[model samples]
Target: MFFNTFSWKEFLLRKIISLLTVLLLVVGCENNKKSLEPITPEDFLIIAHRGASAYAPEHTIPAYEIAQQADADYIEIDLQMTKDGVLVAMHDEKVDRTTDGVGFVIEYSLEELKQLNAGRWYNSANPGLANKEFEDLKVPTLQEIFSHFGNDVNYYIEMKSPKIYKKMEEKLVSLLIQYNLIRANGELPKVIVESFNEDSLTRLHQLEPKLPLIQLFYFKEEATLSVQHYNRLSNFASGIGVNISSVDNDFIQEVQLNGFQVYLYSINNEIEMKKALNLQANGAFTNNPDMGISVRTEFEK
Candidate 1:
């Protein structure tokens, strides 16, 4: 009786419209997934900034082990070079802040840098969380990190002050090759190379097109990226990493619309973590992996 009430042409048109609606929803869902690929390629990523730097001195083996123990998705490392041309994991150009040394990281030989007590500063800085066992940890070279963690862990490495380190890109690529972390066959590594300098990222991208390179931006105030900026970064960067102060949901949505993932920097607490999730960011760099994990769990629920 319902069929008899409608013309055959009208029924055919209705079916076609329904089919188009289904098609649009599928397309919309696929686009949503594309925006999320950088975060574990499907799941959200928790990058342990400086190996859970909140609990231990950053860039030390103990810090890295703590991050791994918490099952972090990636460990974020800021790399600086030594005078002897060794690549070491360190966040600052000057060693004064985190170590018992007073000079630029590049001025010291690996042996010289190693002599500095890398973990002592944390005890004095955070007396409540101080540990006597952190007395004399050595700075870890890139090779040492590779040897320690192997392929079981993913690394989010930044070439800190890359221009200051001659052939830093080449040396980094060489080590990755030596460790079989990258291949000439276009197989990608779990590693993601990021930098604040566009030129540094460009050089690294040229070195390995298969590698995912991220361009980082800093802002003292609210952050925003122009359409032109997004266009330019898309030329080389797989995505962009911005300070939490610099981003909002609109920025995240717009960047994703331009076909790039957006990762926020330095989320250290549940409030900040929730802000990141609320903004629909792909992921964030966090100093407390366990807390990040818990916040993500609760937020999803």
Candidate 2:
């Protein structure tokens, strides 16, 4: 009887060990599923600020072409008006900062704006990089950008001045339609329109409810306002676009909690670039698309 009892005990012990092993195997599979899950950074996009302005003068075909060559995911184009009320790709309402002109872009006709030396200012600080290879480069129209680089690159168009708010959405949508950028078959160019003037974006949303819109904010207390404003604007925006100084994981997380993405602007340095990635930002606007691409590639490795 003692011998029989010993056999039964040994059998029960073996069954308990086997059951524990099976449970562990099931738990291991569950853990693997969690570990192998996909993350956002894997598909994060890169936007070239002002058409890779670090390599060439901003908002010109030469600059945009460089952005494409650098493999940027999108080329940011800021829009302003010419005297004739035509939309042109430019950062400032005034041409004094980046061109050889002395007044507001709207003051000159397209013919007059085209004649100024757009490449002249580039030679002052970056002579070696300037070389005037693109000297006398003329300002390009919204239509011209689409004509020259259509469908080949994505665009991040910012309606710079709300003074043209009346015609801004109509003109932009018309051109995008002309170029077939807003696809009928669901192949749109992934255009993202941004503006500090919330009403401008709201207007676009009213016009084309499907187009992605971003709410841009810039303030002295940039970091603090980033969260507060993004929360308020989330009702109308798909994402938040703010100065690089304003981006942080906290802001990004807060934006994400509200079901919005984040795009940080004008980051050109290695430190800030790395910070953007570490924060898992949805995208970055950079003057050097090549630098952004290279660092992003390295970090993934």
The lDDT for every candidate, in the order shown, is 0.82, 0.77
TM-score of 2: 0.81
Model 2: per-residue Cα lDDT over 1-301, one tens digit each: 9999999999999979855644554344333321111113344677998998988889989999999999898899999988787899888889998888889988889999988888768878787797657777888999999988877888889999966534878889888878877642233335778899888887887777667778887746646443345434544677778777766675566556555668887789878888888998888899998999998888788
Worst 10 residues of 1 by lDDT: 31-40
Q: What TM-score does model 1 achieve against the real structure? A: 0.84
Badly placed stretches (over 4 Å) of model 2 are 1-42, 183-189, 225-232
Which regions of candidate 1 deviate over 4 angstroms? Answer: 1-40, 183-189
Among the numbered candidates, top lDDT falls to: 1
Candidate 2 residue pairs in backbone clash:
none
Query: Ten-residue segment with the worst summed lDDT in candidate 2?
Result: 32-41
Positional deviation of residue 205's Cα in model 2 after best superposition, in angstroms: 0.6
